[model samples]
Target: MTIHTTSSCTAFEGVRRIASGALRDVAAAVKRAHDRAGGEPILVFDDATSSPIEFDLRGGVDDVLARLADAAANGAGAAGQDDEPAAARSRGRPKLGVIAREVTLLPRHWEWLNAQPGGASVALRKLVDAARLARADNERVRLAQEAVYRFMTAMGGNLPDYEEATRALYANDRARFEQMIAGWPGDIREHAAKLAAAAFCEVT
Candidate 1:
């Protein structure tokens, strides 16, 4: 049977043809997709039904399963790997695997880190990471607040003091703090939460 595939940002659409008798003999093709990709593989039974017929990709399915299998794997998009940190899932809680070395920073450099919110008790790595994370987070907060403002504007309301309101939420206003997701997409909430956790070293 001849097989053809076309791909989109998150989907792979394809078709295969086989002898009517061979329709019951698709064990090898499923094995191929499973070996190449580590996830559940799908098969389409009929062109009219968009949903895939579930098959165990761990082994193989029969030839009858071949033509019927329309696989749709959600391909990871253009977000580069570096766009996020690796998963830190482990038992208990994720630990920061930090290796420390003593360095003689100039008095000025030492003073700078010592003046941070955590003060000198904070590790140098933590201070630097916190600074970087704070910068990125501030940008995200701004974008989120802007989204909220845009939403409000759509309702014929005006947002006053965008920066002041954002700062208030980030600091003293817990109610607004919990509700300031401006223009952020839904998928990024988990990522943003994770980043916030890692930055603050807080357990959610």
Candidate 2:
């Protein structure tokens, strides 16, 4: 299976967000801020993870831009390929990192699995895979909500209606969340909305 990922970054100057976009764009924004604002602590964060990313700002804007360009090029090339090698399947067992683990189940459950096509192990694998596929959307929404909450806690924790905003976030109340943060700084509000965008259902 191939796993695809999207990368986003945000740069902040004190309490205010300065920029948010692709890695290269955010890096450029941070570099520009560092140059124009002197040593005033400019923090860059991974929008998905809400963690601070450190860059060698001492190397100047051109060097920073060059590094970002190289990284983006490398990432683009790598993203097209699967991380795993394709291998032929064996008769009874496959070489796809199958691990042996003891799963204690009731006798009836064991009997049901044993009666399925390809017996217990294959049946279990199929069931697990089906469940994973079914839950993928919910998992994505949960992860997106968590990411947005983390970013908000770091950026808007000191802002007005912080607790109410948090409640609205977890409650999946996009409208209320937006209303709570309506008075926040433009950049911060926009970034928060972007982060939480995936977590909410359309109001229709």
Candidate 3:
């Protein structure tokens, strides 16, 4: 059974956005754009991580999409696209999708962990989940910034204030970031800001 993996994708022809939607639709749009009279430099990106999608559009649109489906079925998808997790049998709750892995702890730490209500594994999982909850806001900011940086490096590298805009992005200076990107290509600026919007929501 082919497990369908869905990912949000966007394509830009030069500095203008040509399409934004599911991977299949974006791939079709990209192929059509690339086949135009004057072929433009079209790049499809995974919105989650701002990583480029390299499609082999050698044959017709159906052929291109077929290759993508085949890759997804084999768990060999382009980086940055979210994929359904593959099932793996291991020494723990495989039904719960848990895979056992070796974890090392100091003797004192191990002793403390082993004494917890449900032993080390359950205790460790609880600790990890709690930590994630605590760091959720900061984690979102970090991920958003990373995605913005990737898009900037790919599309805005040669824009006038690229370096300053990037610095402002990381520094959480919204005003400065806006000013720095003021002179950039319109679509690039808008898309970069869109990717970074969530990061700044918790800035204050």
Best by TM-score: 3
- Write down the RMSD of candidate 2 (Cα, Å): 7.3
Question: Per-residue alpha-carbon lDDT of model 3 for 99-201, expressed as tens digits?
Answer: 8899988999999999999999999999999888768878888999999999999999998999999999898888899999988888888999899896665
Error of 2 at 177 (Å): 1.4
Each candidate: what lDDT? Answer: 0.39, 0.79, 0.84
Q: Give the count of colliding residue pairs in each prediction.
A: 16, 0, 0
Q: Candidate 1 residues 38-101, lDDT tens each? A: 4443342321111223334443355324443533211222222354445753457767786767
lDDT of the structure predicted as candidate 3:
0.84
Deviation in Å, model 3, residue 59 alpha carbon: 0.8
Better of 1 and 2 by lDDT: 2
Error of 2 at 115 (Å): 19
lDDT of 3 at 113: 97
Flag the better candidate by TM-score, 1 or 3: 3
What are the root-mean-square deviations of the candidates from the true structure over C-alphas? 17.0, 7.3, 7.6
Question: Quick one: ranking by lDDT, best first?
Answer: 3, 2, 1
